[model samples]
Target: MQPSIMLLLLLPLLLFSAPSISTAQDFDFFYFVLQWPGSYCDTKQSCCYPTAGKPAADFGIHGLWPNYADGSYPSNCDSGNAYDASQIGDLMGSMRSKWPSLACPSGDGSTFWRHEWEKHGTCSESVLDQHAYFQAALRLRSQVNLLQILQNAGIRPDGGFYSVRGISSAIRSGIGFEPGVECNVDDAGNRQLYQVYVCVDATGKRLIECPVLPTSKCSSRVEFPPF
Candidate 1:
């Protein structure tokens, strides 16, 4: 075979074998964080419901954060790619249901959603656009069913304190992977359950082992305050 022909034949193999390169903003996984409304309200003194009114007795979506395998993450990746509430029209209903803002002076959840989108969603642009990013979080929330899992484990949010082991076990049993549990101290100095963060693959489609286990100040027993 001619040298030139040999080189041409090997070109495709060389290209295929080369390692894929990614930019700094690229991420490897997602942290789907769900916050407990009761805990948030208890800590914040007051809570504001969306214009649609108070959310149901369920964990609200804090954000779907993009994380790297190295335990680092990117934020505000694209300053130009600002959040636009109008783009997420169809998702508004679900967002209100599963991801309502419990911050003060709510009514419009857009501000909170915008912050999440701009800060975290932009970092995931390589895999998900604005709409898909929000939708993925909603879908993950529905799929995880954290409330149902805890309830089935006799861990209702009735202002009862639950063992961190029990809480983690319930989630692991329900979702097939251990999740990170976080807590906060209310005004009364009670250690209350705050958030549950489950790691998802970069595609935001499937759960994966967390690259770095989440650390929490939550003790062996954490309160599951009622909303």
Candidate 2:
């Protein structure tokens, strides 16, 4: 599991746009994973990557942001006991380096604590501008689930998990691949549990399902989280 601070750091990154991915349908890995409406795949790249990247496996926090480093992941090509814990460590360090001012750090500015700007408090407009930055950070931390799933499934050059995406209500209701599921053990010795789903919609924003509470909308237009 990621430390609470690192997860907080990624909030801003979720609020913004990620780099574009080429989804030409011929020999493109993305072709196997992304699902979208209509022929829009030719022009719109928003829902292409993050949505496609889901279901490859139940990556932990990485499930939130699949477009990291141009979308080719498990760059080390090692998995299982063969996996490198050091690489995961490197990812943590690298993320902090890329966005130091974000909420990945402990204390103050933590995502667990709402920003004064979010609260419309004493902070000025300039401070409020930072909210976009925090949202992006949140999105990235949410992708941790992808990394865990990749490692758990031993994804590699010779063999790896395969993910496919489609918007059919039938598909979503079937027993096929699930994009945003995460694994977590209960502290009280209960069985592991499946967390919410995370994904980007056609509008490129984030969404979450509380089931009991109303779905919380994120800054990006089409993103959605695990239910």
Candidate 3:
């Protein structure tokens, strides 16, 4: 056999056997983020309800993102494993309700989910495979009633502005840990309650106090926009 032919034939085998590149898998905690649907839709870019129809009038799962204690995070840790919705087929009903996508162009929530899994979920694959990751987030979402928590604290999302600290206190009262409240400006430039970041153990179970939080751009009061 010619040397070139031998090299060409052996190339496929070498490529197939190449070592998988290592990614930063170790992480300190998770930001089990829940987003307000109304705030999400009221932004300048706007949003589209899922093809599964409108989600419930409540906070929904944004992601279960892995992060370092220093506030740094990991992402795209598994290029080899893309999000296969079939892996989480059984969780669709819950996902459609608890994690609906409101981004354009319109979608059934898969694109949003795929972006989350690939960017955030993949970093935690060492602990939870795709199915477990999605399931665990749903479980966490079920455990906390964010809307009820705020309402109980007299912070209704009736397009009324409320103290940011008070909102955090309400969540801590309900869930036993203070949460990080993030806000965004609406189309009319009103700062609205956007996402609530709660920390979780590395295993994606049980909420914990956040080690670091997204810089809160909220004022003394932020609008809890109506859905």
Candidate 4:
């Protein structure tokens, strides 16, 4: 065949064979992780309140990470899909309130959010856009009153300790699924409640049974420190 004919035959294949950003959909589920601010601040490393002021003494969102069923996960799936604050302008208030960052030298939660978006959120772009990604998390956060759930079950955060089984059981009873409880040490090196990981479906909505739970370093009885 002539060079021109050969080029024409390969043009369609070349265009279609390009890698796509939507392969991010292949992940099995999302780990909707929420961290307790009191436990976070109680650590020796400490934490700083956001510039806007302190967040509520409740569970703050960590990230809605995509993960495989076999304990593997994907991240930074699409460099092209950069984090843009403007895209989620309408949901700014919800984001700041529910997903506040407790990290030191905190300006606003934007830096934390951008990092989450770039690292984890980008992996879920197949099912959610930039706006939907944040909105889904905010909505999910509202649905689960974690502190209320634990308190209602007599698991108050008054520097008291409770069995890890008890904590997970109460949350599971309230939400109808098992929860992954992670603990961190306080200034004095006592293990305290830190983060709670709940599984959400791939759609980023609806609570589901965790295909696999995150490894929690909690002692048999972990402290739930007050803020």
Candidate 5:
């Protein structure tokens, strides 16, 4: 065989034998979502108490969302690892106290939690199982006391609009890293403080800086609606 022809044949074999690139879903960090009660339940049409009852005036947990460094996130990555409420029996009390669902016609908060676990928790199985995932979120919420920190900084939730810089600064000072602040406009066309998201390491242990901070739609002045 000619040397050039032999080389061409070998090239095809080599190319076909190379390992295929994987499309398996993986995550880098977590977004611990905290929802402001006032913002969540502002409109009569939007508010609904859970079977467990209404959440306190404090911020209620939204979810511990798994996210990529490129600002994308994964959801329902593994349906086989479906959420099991029985598995989280021990965490019920803490979840009720800290992570209650404020959606309408709430049914013991199971639906909300199930949705979160299935969507976000399934993506974190390698780092934390079902129990650990919920527990980590609860612990993070307890550690990052948003209300108290803002209170100390004189930023009360008294239906008053505050500067975006001031709100972000208070959270950054409290948690050692700047967070992604979200806001929504109320019936009065006023931008109300909504959800606050903080990035957490994959192990669900440490709070880390977000590779790509979430955009805040809030204007220069946002109202911290009263609970």
Candidate 6:
């Protein structure tokens, strides 16, 4: 075969064997909510317990109602706090600077939470909102150097909560990214907390679901990579 012809055939094989390139979603993760502690499913697309990756999992994307009681779960979250964009932005910036690999967006976590808030359109909002906001951002957080963000935010990566109904429904629907809980264990018994799960697309654009825990908070630490 001609030298040029031989090169062309080899090039195709080399390209085929090359590993796939990483995208935003590879660094980004998503979490769908099955239900809030007190809030009920408001729409048919919404439900108390839903599959991991379905749209119905977004039912409790926002904070839960404080006054409403759902069977056993009581709303202990502070539902009276106002949204603070500045503080959230500051924290996000800090996280971004610390972890340039994951490339966290610069802005207030409250802004995204605001969208969730608008989705819910309920009066329930509080310090708990701050907790949820920060945790959601951490879902995409990388750069093992930024341990302080977890510490300051009070997020236990090793502890998280999931809904029984939501897990079961996810098992039945079998259409979404089967939801699961993750945690981060710190020194000894101290652990970082991550209450929200934020799922993203390849470019990190689509936010499929953003669930809120009814009463329990989960951890967000990644252990395999040894962070």
Whose TM-score is higher: candidate 1's or candidate 5's?
A: 1
| Candidate 2 runs further than 4 Å off | 1-64, 68-106, 109-179, 201-203, 206-227
Q: Give the clashing pairs for model 1.
A: none
* Regions more than 4 Å wrong, model 6: 1-79, 93-111, 115-133, 136-227
Worst ten in a row by lDDT for model 1: 17-26
State the lDDT of candidate 6 residue by residue for 1-227, as single tens digits: 99999999899888876765422121122233322211222222222222112221111232322222121322223344544555466564433332112112323234535544343322223222454544443443431112333234332222343333333233323333333333333344433222223333322224443233233334332221111
Clashes (backbone N, CA, C under 3 Å), per candidate, total: 0, 55, 0, 0, 0, 32
Residue 196 of model 6, lDDT score? 29
Write the residue-wise lDDT of candidate 4 on 66-167 in tens digits: 999999999899999999999999998888889999898977899999999999999898899989999999988998889999999999989998999999
Clashing pairs in model 3? none
Error of 1 at 2 (Å): 5.0
- What candidate 3 gets wrong by more than 4 Å, as runs, is 1-25
TM-scores of all predicted structures? 0.90, 0.22, 0.88, 0.89, 0.87, 0.22
* Candidate 5 vs. true structure, TM-score: 0.87
The candidate that achieves the highest lDDT relative to the unseen native structure: 4
- Positional deviation of residue 188's Cα in model 5 after best superposition, in angstroms: 1.3
Question: Which model, 3 or 5, shows the larger lDDT?
Answer: 3
Q: What CA RMSD would you report for each candidate? A: 3.1, 23.0, 7.9, 4.5, 5.1, 20.0
lDDT of each: 0.89, 0.27, 0.91, 0.92, 0.89, 0.33
Q: Model 6 — TM-score against the truth?
A: 0.22
**C-alpha RMSD (angstroms) for model 1:** 3.1
